[model samples]
Target: MPLLDPARWRLLHGGEAAAVEPATGEALGTFTLAAPSDVEEAALTAARAQRAWATAPYSERAAVLRRAGDLIRRHEPEIGEWIVRESGSIRGKADFEIRTASEECYEAAALAHRPLGQVLPSTAPRLSYTSRIPAGVVGVITPFNAPLVLAARSVAPALALGNAVVLKPDPRTAVCGGHALAAVFAEAGLPEGLLRVLPGGAETGRALVEDPRVRVVSFTGSTRAGRAVGELAARHLKRAHLELGGNSAFVVLEDADLDAAMSTAAWASFFHQGQVCMTAGRHLVHSSRYDEYVERLAAKADSLTVGDPYREQVHLGPVIDRGHLDRIDELVRGSAAAGVRIAAGGRYRDLFYRPTVLADAGPGSVGASPAYGREVFGPVAPVRAFDTLDEAVALAGDSGYGLALGIVTRDTARALDLADRVPAGLVHINDQTVNDEPIAPFGGLGDSGTGSRFGGEANLDAFTETRWTTVRATPAAYPF
Candidate 1:
């Protein structure tokens, strides 16, 4: 039987939603949409199951996660196929997602063995200590871009920490992101009801956040949506872990290696068609090399191919759907209208938007364009010139987002100095902006999110609450 077999769980409502292939506009399959009532039921079910799952042996929980990781690795080809066809990911990106998702499970398994509490000194004649306890049921809302890895990072850790999860994956990539993840857990012997996959839209996400039984909400999406989720979660008095959007900056110093820097910039800006939250949307190069940098980057962008990844060996796939394609096109066109020279690529065919580079997007002109500091989640790189380190730092931190920042220079000391002044949560002195590791804490600052980092030791803090306890051999005298 398939892991996503409808018989496994009750998907309320008589209607179904289609999961269409973005590249071909063909229906890959259909899934029942969960109503608000169904979300309520899922939370209740997860809460009930969490009681037993929480008390289960830590070894058992760890085993389940480890097995899931193995299963994902074992079925990489099959799952990769689903990701490519459903999410419009290039084959290389699909492979990266599979590998990273599996690593998330493996790392989460290790989380089971981390120190759960600490002993503290007490003022009285008593033993005092703190214990980390699960936060009951957790609500996870994941976006379509890089869904598998994003979902796994939260789901695996929540489960490993003894909390049940009710996942709401983006409906568009449900098959690869939602069903595949749940299937791996089921095959790994995870207890039923401990994890629920409810592929849905905003209504479903809101329902999950508002559900009383869900104590913690893990969300990954746009900054606008993340703000709403944070507000709603706060109104409900629940903790929300939001890893939102970014218009990250990639700074190139006069002393940097243009060849290597440009390569990193291309990958950072155009990887996965730049759907990533950490995409290097702004490029600040020193005035000495600004023109050369733009020309070389434009040539690189033009050399890359965009097509249906499932049928061709291409650098990039479709831009998720027509709506997303239109949004990217609008950004490029709007910037061009504002006198931002289009160094290369300002067009698209079907759903494939070409990788574009904008030059002469200085502080005065492009800064006024909508695509300047805004999160243009597409394959568009806007380059600006900076004269000194101070100006570069100012330009990089000018945006409301402070998710990730990159600085490339041979002067390690200067690069480190620049990193100190940047407001971003994650910074790379010698590398590009788009980077993630299962063991590293990942998050952003300001409008980007609440700075509730995820992964490694941070997962324990995000998924569990600390309870202080004290024991005494005799009762203390009371003032009564």
Candidate 2:
């Protein structure tokens, strides 16, 4: 069977664009792009659907979401394979994404019937209460990396909250991610026009954000693109939930076990080719273990298998595209020239970049070179040595992006202290930097995001609005 059948779904507008398999540069299929007018139409349709969906019975909404989850699980193998072809994810990672996305649908389904109102005391002869209401039309813009999961992160919650959604997925992976999601919901008995999937680039996203009918915008992508979305949403007085980029810091303390740290570090830095936003960009090691840690990490990188994503033993796969591959290569070259020594794999064969580890990439090198300072968004780990716990904390807090931080230590007191001091939104102790759960508050700090989080109870706030109401037994006296 073909990886994707474009005719199985609907398209809004625009010309056709090819969906290329990153692993082999094969043209999976040509898909129709969503134009600006299509975005406008989707917003209008969402507004209409939202009016009815918002008043739907909680049971009805919950049932639909539950069905969607079941469908996703039942078709995980096919969807996972499509994800590998569309987004260049290896088998394990692709399956993980599909499973996570399916779980998100179930988690979100529970929220449908959950309590959404609060009763408050009133000073006068009146009863006061606040109820959560849908934020009208929700515009979701998701990135290619982990597209299915990210879309589910926003779409499921918004739908569960009774808000109709207009999803604009990255053009590169729209078939397996966005269009697939739309089809799943439709099959699950969701009303027509309630969820619209439009695959396109910046123009479609801009149109969705600027559309007056779209009351809320949920975006997950690069910090640069997120900033533009925020600005556009702000100008239109629309609510925006931004999950942007990250340059997470992985700290290895002296008390940490070398073998454990090395294993976690390898996965955190190289998984999904480090295309994940929460991938650890910097490894801050205690001077006591820096040398041995780097040596072990280098060996681990050399052992990883990089080839066909479908192969059971393949550990890594190609990046999203050639442009990104070129960018990763440039960063490695520039960093190498800045006196940063490559301790492990540093070369690229086609779209597959070998997992790379850089030594002596301390504050000086990071600040002096873009490759070290900015989010590399590739399978590269820059290890820096720090003498004191305070220095490690300082180094981790140096970046403008603060999505997540990892601390590997046996001392609970020291770990807690450092976690408190770190500016990141999510802090992990004895774990890798790349982590997420359906019920946790997922977002970042500073340029990493706009202080808005999605997941768990946070999704209720992001996808809904609170309205206060009061009931009076008698007419209130007014001042003359």
Can you write out model 1's per-residue Cα lDDT over 319-391, one digit (the tens) per residue?
8888888988888888888888999898899999899999977555444676775788999999999998899
lDDT of 1 at 188: 99
Which of the numbered candidates is closest to the native, going by highest lDDT?
Answer: 1
> Looking at model 1, which ten-residue stretch has the lowest summed lDDT?
1-10
My TM-score estimates for the predictions, one after another, are: 0.98, 0.98
The reply for model 1, stretches above 4 Å from the true place, is: 1-10, 364-367
Predicted structure 1: lDDT: 0.91
Cα shift from native, residue 480, model 2 (Å): 3.0
After superposing all C-alphas onto the true structure, candidate 1 shows an RMSD in angstroms of 1.4
Q: Could you give candidate 2's per-residue lDDT for residues 1-480 as a string of tens digits?
A: 333357854455688888889888888778789999988888888899889999999999999999999988887877887899889998888878878888899999999988989999988788999999999999999999998999999999899999999999999999777988887898889999899999998888888899899999999999999999999898999889999999999999999998777889999899999999999999999999999999999999999988778654689999999999998988888888888899998898899899999988866645465566889999999999999988888899998998999999999789999999989999999999989899899999998998899998999999999999999988889996
The per-residue C-alpha lDDT of model 1 at residue 158 equals: 98
lDDT, candidate 2, equals 0.89
